[model samples]
Target chain A: MKKLLLLLAIAAFCMPTWSADTKNLKYVDGTTLTIINKPQHDGNRLRRINTDKYPDLTSRVRHYLNMPTGMALRFRTNSPVIRAKWTTLDTLRHTNMASISEKGLDLYIKQDGKWLWAGFGNPKFEGTKHASTMINDMDTTMKECMLYLPTFMQVNSIEIGVAPDSRIESCGDIKRAPVVAMGSSYTHGSGTSRAGMAWPAQLSRMLGVDIANYGTSGQQKMEQFFADIICDTDADMFIFDCFSNPSPKEIHERFAPFVKKIRSKHPSTPLVFLETVDREWKNFDLKKRKFENDKEQAAREEIAKVIANDPNIYFFEPGLYTGTDHETSVDGTHPGDMGYQRAAINIAEKINATPALKKIIDAAKAKDCCKSPCKCPASKK
Target chain B: MKKLLLLLAIAAFCMPTWSADTKNLKYVDGTTLTIINKPQHDGNRLRRINTDKYPDLTSRVRHYLNMPTGMALRFRTNSPVIRAKWTTLDTLRHTNMASISEKGLDLYIKQDGKWLWAGFGNPKFEGTKHASTMINDMDTTMKECMLYLPTFMQVNSIEIGVAPDSRIESCGDIKRAPVVAMGSSYTHGSGTSRAGMAWPAQLSRMLGVDIANYGTSGQQKMEQFFADIICDTDADMFIFDCFSNPSPKEIHERFAPFVKKIRSKHPSTPLVFLETVDREWKNFDLKKRKFENDKEQAAREEIAKVIANDPNIYFFEPGLYTGTDHETSVDGTHPGDMGYQRAAINIAEKINATPALKKIIDAAKAKDCCKSPCKCPASKK
Candidate 1:
């Protein structure tokens, strides 16, 4: 009996601590993960811009700021399975946009120098709190990963789960300066099917630099407070997709001051203005055509004046952002995932075409190269 | 007092019968309109395939058939405004698909020689009954139009409204035979943002022929009953997207019998089989990769035997139906609108490239020439 008891105790001591069941997985607070694509990490880590810092902004703009449009959490882990539990501030839903893009999470794994989509976290139908198993059953290799937050809903709390014995750690911040984008619903990812497919997120992955999104839905009307926020942001470049929502009169009144305020703070930072893509519904509605044409003309006039005066400022007319087929939009106004992809590539091409913009992006890339122990000139300096 | 009353009565009688307010707009039952892209009108006008005709089908297949996958209402009207009121059979919602694509109505207007998207009817967030103004403030020119029904929800009742004084009439059925498509959720527009963006609908518009959709969601397993329905369908061509849902063993057991059953009824009908698309998630999940590879190999082996014996049968492997960039799907398995667009174009190209298929399509076009006064050979006959 003594010998048997001793053998049982020895076996118990040698048993492994972890189990394969996902219920045994350990969860880490999302805030502890490396939050990326934000101009400043002052208030909520999930939100793109802090509302408390600018109290004078319109209530609508402040509300929209609470939603994380293009934010992502970066981490490294060797766990084969990943899970997420989160609560949205409001269980908001849209008719034309999928709930996965509006309030759920999207996961991407970095494989061999490229980030590929791995899985999606599906949101509950009618609830604020939701949980989903993102991906499972893979060889446990240390992999860098990104989890994109909700594009059109605010987050209250989030937790990421990994295997009990796996190593998980934050991927620290990117050393290079980020590109700041301010715009309307198109930039807010209104018609995309996943959060990571948003144009700003696509631009970041394509350029290998951070692109902080400050899209405010229908509230991006070139407000002075927005200019105040943009001017103070730490960025290598600024892009404005702000021409779509404001009235022609408002554009005429606010365009010059908005540009001047940003220039006053960061005079040498490259600024790019994008003309609004023509809405598909305008083809049949003459009234909308005239209204949009007037707005476009006003934007062109203001941009022409700014471009002539400032050598660092550049303007790009709408290219094949949404293809010429006129079948890319969901509600005749908001472009779907395909349009967003085309828009990202078109914007990148435009940036590469200009020497000034290319120089700024190249400089940022050089700074990124200095992160490792190397003999590169940037590292040596 | 009597004189004043008489004058009031006279004024009331002189007033026009029609009012500009949409509240006063007259409603027409959707069934009164010309229904298009149906194989046989034996049961419910909205459903793709009637359950009563195929009692042997699985309950899941029967349930999916109740949803109006690609049915449309054809009409002509001279109204400045168009509106719709509908009650869905069940107010269903999906997390990964938008409500607009699941339950809402999409309107297209024929202009010159092409059908162009005019507007979309947004469904109520949490209700069975919904009403919306699809379009307003257009010139009162007589226009032919198509209104695509919900792709994933069944309709209990639907009514189209127009200005009280406007002329509205049915635009009778097309003279040419429809192309019948049988498949899974992709053909049912699972990832598309609107009902009209489904691949079958896109194929119809691109080819200028009616293409009846018989998609049954996750239940398209190449069943013997499905073969009975397809064999009886009045079609110029039959397309099978049936290899996705079945297991390799099921395919080995059912594929030859399923094809042979259809061929038994129609000896010379052109039959086309589409190989299942490679799921994007398989690229990362090795288990799924092997499983899907096995299924594909089974399909190829079975198809090789059929093609060797039959000359009228054709097979198409997965092409660039979704672009190579791997960013076109909403879920890893289902293609979004861009992917559907690519699939439609690719399928159309394949059909035109083949002499046997092109000859059949051309014959259908020639028959369509008899619609009006003409000197064409088909019209003379």
Candidate 2:
């Protein structure tokens, strides 16, 4: 009996076995999905921020507050699951910040024409502090997926992993003129659950275009440093949604100057100036109500002064944050997911109908916006 | 001159270093924040689902699906940032899955009596597959915070790290018997940007109590295996919100039996049976409308049959999802943060008002549920 059992065990061992086929697995950079807002940089850092002249790091907040925000990638793959390896330069932990998946990789896949939750990569903290780490084993059977990078951490680089035999591909070239939005935490995705659920991200999904988010938390003060960067950035359109961050005095002093700086660089690019989302509780609180209303009027006058001479500039009408109430905010300052969605749909409609923006979209379509220009569909047609 | 320069650099490094005071930093296990619904296990794994009798791991979804869903902890810390280290057992990868902050440690802190964004621990994926990782340097100045575990991955164990000099304390004791919730994806926190944003988590925060989330995605069938596990769980209340996953036929056939099983174990425990959240599109789509209506009727009927004789069980009133619309969900089935909050507030009010439930809360208040019996505040009071 023992000899027979041994023979059976040997036979089982000799039989061919199936593993994940990892040997055939290949790593793809997934760059085609529009690594939005990230400019080319030397060294290991991938920065959406143009921090060439950022102020000295005074506190830990300074170290973490200026990493990439609203930067993400979309792609398609046949792998049942996706794995990744990357590292962040800063580690800023807060209970709410950490709980919301900030500074970590988040994924959503299109399933049956709707985006579904698949899973997320885990952060293993070991090895050299300066180098990258691996977050493995996300489960999904979908062929296409969108990845939102960490909103608060600067990643050195990222490498997408799949089964050795699986195929990986990026979402191709930026199909439309990218939408560049600069603002405060509202644009930076404060109350939304994940980076992809932010207003700009939702607009990107709705329009099937790339929307680069340059929203910084508590830092969108119409600084010359940011204006200089915007002048140098490449975008078919620009949206300034910083009414919530700066005071009325600062708006009067700096709004026109910033617009002029950008106009000097890209005179014909379409620009959209958004007034602040209304405070729902203003009717009940007289003091707070007056403060917000006063800011709104000042912003309106400043935007009017800046766009009066620029034919390409338009103001996004107020009431975009309709259906909002006290519950729409995380803490009466940041819009929750519901409020974020309202803003996204409103902006998507405004941008979709604007004639100046239409021209940019139409031109990109006519030219086929193809990275491989030799194989341009418009030329072939 | 070169030697002198080196000497100066060394002196600079050695003279009264102003770091976070490493010697004062201490590592504490955050498991005290109500590791609810998890059965005592001898290994490092922290599992909320009844995996002891779980079905075969035929698909990647099944493997990742059965891991922790809403298992989290709450504590107070004076540390500017809270950090953690953990290891996951299986590394399942998918684009949508990897893009989420799943299987990752997330943190939230209380600021001005509201939870605010702090930061998150970065996972380092290197070295042996089964080893610990250190997610360091979360920036904070808050003295109190809450931490949520990964939604998808099975963590072996976790160690919370703080500045060497900072003190770490669990939330003293659960103020009430932890609310143990069992259901489908909604209970699992689908569409929530972070684990703590799930409906149950929201309830926990709202009531200042502990909640153990045992929400399984696509696996909330009322099988005897699961019923057996629930019989053993320790909770102040049991909320069954699995109407979306089971068919009317299953409700008629198995619902009463499952309730009876729990009643057999704890006759007086408060039980709340909830119908599924109304499908937002049902009002507009005929087929979906019928399907949802049928489920609602079946659940109502089943609850009636089970609660006919039992005074402890109560049917959760309809309209828990009253303020919701299609936009409140990621997909039609799962609630986003808005939907989740609406449900949480509604349910919290109902539970707070229920006579049977209030008895449980009152009793708990009278006898403190502190971790260390010697430190029991109720006795002292």
Candidate 3:
């Protein structure tokens, strides 16, 4: 059995899924999807903004929402492009400099030549009688974008030192919540920034659970990828969706071993295996006579069956939705809300119906017996 | 002097700019910014997508799009993960499944299993059906989001194909037009699925010149990536705004290398560099520190200047709007229309002001120049 497994592993390693090469590329016309993973620092600074501050930017406001103190302020020419190091605070600022009426604004400037920087601070943002030298002048459009509103004059610094009490609470100490989806960029919550649309993100919203997304584009299948995902964070449940790369035989060899390794560590954790379907599959390239589509789908099914023997392993098939039926997917592959709803429904139903969940919920009820989202204390009540 | 130059070169190499390490980590909240190089397909069947029939989508839409086809559309069913596979017409006959469609309607379906995939074909979608599914099967709040008019379908196939004509069109074939932006996700106009909002789409409206978008997401910096952009396609002034990565060093090392490589070969094609920016820096833990913020910006400027010496390498700075400024960024990084419009203005201004551009415009005025969507040649001309 060991030898056979080794052979299978080697077989999986041999077959690589290379995307078909094309001469003419159809660049999908859509918004570039970005992943925002930076933690915001609520620096306690008011003047931290050298650029005009718009109150409506919630993300920005959120960063500074918990600011503990005031910020340090810096000044520059109209643009953030500090042309020459601030030899002296040049009083020459944008015309909107008049808006700095809250305080006086005047400074001297000098450039030996090389670069630009913000030097001495102007205590007053507005002062009438100061004629300052302008460095690289701001252009016309710059005027338009600033909307005639005054820019905050260069840069600002805000100090946000945290108290000893406020820090990343350890998951073990705090009854860790297990609701993170781990996978590739697909799970990273790509597109829907407005609504936060990645499948896992949508799932998080639907389930009302905090989903720690451990997805990175182009990093799927790397051994280190999963090691970090499993070892770095703690979660109650893990929706395993790593089927994008592994070849047919490879999945068979890997799934059993990987799941076994995970089970040893997280013996009781509900590990749900999610198989993905690509929109490109529907694009029709192969000969149907050979049941090429079925061959591929069968391959996926075989992998599912291979893992299905374990009663704890929950397997999902991508049925139930009327495909291509709704204008739900922005790209035929990635679904929009219609797709989101379908995904939520399918996932939640399966989760709710699971015996493992029933056991956990029942056990929790027997102990604390509060409503859902209950705090399951570890006092052995 | 040579030793000094060598010392300077070594100093430049040893002096690193980016200290932010993005190593083994799931995500960093707002700080994660991933920029795709000029990505292209590395496979064959997928290339079928570029056919002229689906001129926009590429010719082999069915194969490239990865949608399902045929009568039965044999989808795998078992442990019940509905992944795609082509079942025979007889299979469809047995199942009574027909075509797939993405149209005006909502979708909601919950599976009793772990996950579900919609069939290749979309079922009849009535607005009420989706609402009913959400209300009954989904959490009330989640259901509310399910209802919306369809924007665009996730694409699958293009109906066009290009039959090759051996005639070689060199850089000399290019007409010096105002400005044409090329390369992957950086250029092919993205941001929204809507046509008007794409940077190129929007810029063409502003510049009164056709600013073509060659950007495709998930792009990689590769020779194959530029193959079609150079030979199969033509542009006047070109802006390569890919500096978001492949790093500055990569840009300096490969960009000119590629240009010189392309130049050593093509010799006369004009190329410009558009620097990529990450607005996630605004929310960085140290953003309140003016010095840190300026360092990142300065690094971008430094890289810009390194190559700025070449007259043809026009540097397009990321407009002053940080990712936060444009709340429209789906991921606090990819610009939204408001962001794109802002970006377009910067590039448009540069292109219009170039003396080389002035020369091209003058030559055009001397000709008949009344062609609609003028088929202006590329630079070598």
Candidate 4:
């Protein structure tokens, strides 16, 4: 039994964190989050679609039956109190809506007598029964615990700040980073969750940079255009792609000027172009197939041409694989959380293309560096 | 064969019209995206991160290459564009950092000539190769086109507005919603993007109600109470999830009266409570999981009791099982986009328990309205 426990622990630690779908899950030492802004209570009223049918109630819940993303519920102060949606990536299928003890509903609260959270008026609602079909996970995965507090202890309103206090204070003078993207709805990310997907956010993590996201949903070049809200900032650059929204004409038209605009501003900022990602083009429309063929050739040639004279400009072919399919979207255009991870992987790869990595690879080729194929350079040390 | 083609076309139409992964693929319509929101520029700066080894580049790319999110070349602007991560949905293997792309990346482009809307920094660089696996039905998802347009077409700035001309639009002056939230970092949608993955964002979508989200990265709960700019008049309710950071003593000592304070102003408004989300219990050291576990439970229960008699004061179970997982995090405590989605789903389910949705369900149950299951009223045609 001792040996078995040891093996389990080792297996858990040594396991490859990344699976076939997303980036490798890194075991973080501690979690940290900071709120830049909190949800504000705006007094705008929705046209209240379908409301006459269910009057006197706040909103209807029927539309959320199967959507993985939907209208999230919040209290007047903007804290999320209730949520409704279609499907979730929760293969454990642990419904947050669970009514504990077959009380049909449960809530959380502080033992000291404050109300922490409450549950549905109809506590009898059982959770979704078909847990197996609800998930997309591994056999080894177990159901994780999630609890709903009983009503008496829930509270409202609080401050927002960081933890463990990373010595680095402040984002520092609102510095901005130049950015470009290429992918599907996952890239453009939709809904009122402005900037939620991360093409704009993750970049902030990598380079301590800020950028504007110009991605759109469900647009594969049908209404494509170059950058809008081009600022006068000296810190602009361009990154172009035609992967998720494959269109020969749009790419054919936008690539050069897009690059030119950034070159016009931050001429020193490195410009990079991207090749299309992979999927089953043949599986879709004939028009898509035709466009894809044209675009691939055009992309390669244009990339070759652009880089021929300008060394600062570069190109990155997507170097990862994603595992979504036609059914990956709640509506097909917007990638759920899974698709967003795919976009991140591809983006991360492009980020890896810096000159430092190139030197590492060259060193590996020469077989003069450390034993590993890739080596980190001696840093500021 | 003709009949088969017709059938195939019909089938495609019946399928969800959008997919996050399948950009430019087959859609029921032959024509592509009708210009929803006009395209705009998304830019970022590309400061070479890996300079020592690669001398000319930055270290940003080097770190990216180390992860599984494949690489893609991007253009830079104000900030780095990225796909924020979410907790592992137990359904998809529960590996937080799975490989998202299999082969070369898929490029997505808005239909407009917008300059580098994918974000600013160029992801393309030397040595970034394509992933080996490929997502299904995604070949030719997009085409990378290049062209040197006549000089007249380029511009300096364009606005990426939300209007009918764009994909999303809101009308009228209500300008606000019933509820709002104020919190520390936990309130800010972190580890996820702003548009689609934040819990508040997801909750708003689920409820079809406008929720104001003001989450910042790395904020602590203390900051919310200190925030005093007023936007409180429009709201109908408020909720607070400060427990994500509060100590047990804090929950008992500070949370309850804070809620009552807000209630003093909007006496008619409902308030909800939230338990903090933490993962210390998962791998809780010698310490009993009781502190985190029991406290979370107590908080949820207390809220329920308060709301038991009042229609306005409601409680929600913090967790439930659906098809997804809730145990995901980069640092373990912060919920990823998946976690946020899960949080929202939990809230949404409880919202379904509200008297509002129950009235509809009860009426349907009374008549035994539909086919196999208890039928609810049909959606308004």
Ranking by TM-score: 1, 2, 4, 3
Model 2 interface DockQ: 0.06
Q: What is the Cα-based lDDT of residue B215 in candidate 3?
A: 50
lDDT of 1 by residue, A21-121 (tens): 67888899888777777777677777767788898888778878888778887777767678899999774679988889999898888764677888888
Candidate 3 per-residue lDDT, tens place, B311-381, comes to 55545555323233223333323443345555666766765687776565345345412132223243121
Report the candidate with higher DockQ, 2 versus 4.
2
**lDDT string, candidate 1, B1-381, tens digits:** 997687446434443333336788888888777777766666777776568887798877787778777888877777777899999966468887788889999898876457788888899988799898887766666677789899989887889999887876764433224588899887878888999988889888888777788888877889999999987787878998888889999889999999999999988788998888767776455556668889899999999999999998988887327767667768778888888898889889999999988887777665543222222232100
lDDT of 4 by residue, A120-225 (tens): 2112122332111101111121111112211111112111111111111111111122343433334434311112233433332233223333343334342212
Q: What is the DockQ of each candidate?
A: 0.52, 0.06, 0.03, 0.03
Question: Can you tell me which runs of candidate 4 are displaced by over 4 Å?
Answer: A1-337, A340-381, B1-158, B161-174, B216-233, B278-281, B284-291, B297-311, B319-327, B357-381
Candidate 1 docking band: medium
Which of candidates 1 and 3 reaches a greater lDDT? 1
Residue A209: error of model 4 in Å?
Answer: 39
Report lDDT per candidate: 0.79, 0.59, 0.33, 0.32
CAPRI quality band, candidate 2: incorrect
Between prediction 1 and prediction 3, which has the larger DockQ? 1
The candidate, 2 or 4, that scores higher on TM-score is 2
DockQ of 4: 0.03
**lDDT for A358 (candidate 2):** 66
TM-score value, chain A, candidate 3? 0.44
